[model samples]
Target: MHRDFAFIQTAPDRVFIGWGPFEQSPMRKPGRPAFYIADFFLDDPHPWRHPAEWEELTFDALADRAGDAPAPKIEWERMTLADFQPIFDSARAAMRRGDFNKIVPVQFENGHLVERTDLWPWLFRRLAQLPSGMSAYGYSYQNHGLAGATPEMLFASDGRGYRTMALAGTRPADRASELLRDPKELREHRMVVDDIIRRLAPFGNIEVETIRILELPGIAHLATPIRFEEIGIERMSFVEMVRRLHPTAALGMSPRTEAGERWLREADRGVKRRTHGAPFGLEVADHRALALVAIRNVQWHGDAIRVGAGAGLLPESQLEREFDELREKREQVKALLGLRASVAIEA
Candidate 1:
């Protein structure tokens, strides 16, 4: 029998709210969702939970549903550039220490504690606008919401095989050619690809498609799609694939590699992952799953609207360029929300 599902996650295993007559078992046999909307956390739980709470509802399509909801009530938070400098410095130090090959540094921005019922329709419509190669999602209940338009696909599998993208090396589209040639950007992009390939080894012979330039509205990335020829599905569960691939080098270097292990253990102490790089997955059909990274998402944590952005830093990275890259990321969200009081840190 089919069921319903919806959720907005912060990190770890807490939900803003959820309702489910889960059409498919989210952990194992979950089939396609009935208007399925779920979010995953970077803090993946080893032993999974059903997370089903209430019965499903008849969700309306965006065009018909958004008849004329009022504008969102936005309240800006207090923060600035001086506050984010330390994070960059620390990440740089770790790279120099040989403890990290790359570190994604994040900065928290001013909140836009929205008080409105229109957030759901707004977020959904905004998400729908993203073009090919991107996935958008939002979950709102009790009048608060969490949403993102993410370019990186964590993993997607149709009963036939498994595939994912190695997306890294960000630059504005105007610099696309420069990015493709730059040794530093190429090096960083390779690291992300290698991490994905290394982790997928157990699955099968990996066929890596030619790396291409992925152009987004504000930035472009070097993206490579990797397909596994054979998967040891009998011995693995869908979530198990998530466990093996997460904390990816695009965000956190994988601990399984010698260098990545040290980075995970010895790199910048006390700074938890800001975005957490959550892996939100869906069963498009029975046994077919598609998961995306929730990196570009914004959150409303009761008291504040939290937006964050990061750039992968390598020992060879330029602080000024890295800083500029992160600013672009943060600003994209700000512009998307039409918030006037955007905040920034120096490059």
Candidate 2:
């Protein structure tokens, strides 16, 4: 019997799925790389189950379970820092101009290869091999593939209630364990938590925890989890909450729309790469849509890899520190791709 295979494509209605070849990175020959399906999404009955389920199915186990599944086609391309610097600079300048606090800039490359059928399962197997501290999410859009292990909560809703957290501010530490002791970093994180609570006030009774330390693979982040209980309104769906909470101050400045526009305009003019304008894949449902901030992500196209990294810029933000932050974020992508050094930036 012929096996079934599908490629995630965006429709006119704005529905799409994006997967990177993360799991397959280590297996690919040097110079001829492959993209693991990092993210997968579909409207209504999501095509793939929760990421937890995917995690439980390992690569060897999956091969045994579905030996008949078809292979997926791969595409590849390279992204350079020379191409990204102007976009970063523009976002920084926009912050200086007070357009908004920060806006994430992203880029993608098309991987030009195709492998076995049954793409998601194969992709999931690869991701499952990663360390547990990594948070994996599946979205219903073809936005792009993200790799950064961020501690910020973009938006999450559990059918009845909705909650989101802001995670901004940064300090470099030689060890991830030191994040808990950094008072200055904690202060920056607090600013985000305080603002998110204020924004969710109209929805219902909201409770925010005090700042605490959260750790990912190579970094530690100041985290504050906020919870909300639905009040007068009927049970709120995930899409509804995302509409209100997405592009939060963590990704853009307060009054996000204005900040986004300024960064978009500047990035469009300064950067030679493509900017999809808005987040790519947006799935709306009566229940929920887990929207992830497309940060520290990269796109695979044939032999080339395009890595996206940006930092929050405040009036007090230093260019050198911001540069360091970008470097830290790029480290994983470099390691995954087996690249020794990252492309340097003039900024």
Model 1: per-residue lDDT, tens digit, 1-347?
02222443222222222444333333443442322233322333232333355322222334234444444566655444566667667767766776656776555565554453345555544544455656665554454456776788777774567778888888886877677888988988898888888887866778899989998777788989888756554634466777777757887762345665554444334434433366765443355556677777777655556676767877777767777787787667655654444343332
lDDT for each residue of candidate 2 in 75-151, tens digit (9 for 90 to 100):
33344456556656766676677776545554443333244222344343433344442433332223232223223
* Candidate 1: stretches off by over 4 Å: 1-60, 73-81, 114-118, 141-144, 231-235, 254-276, 337-347
C-alpha lDDT of all candidate models, in order: 0.60, 0.45
Clash count for candidate 1 is 7
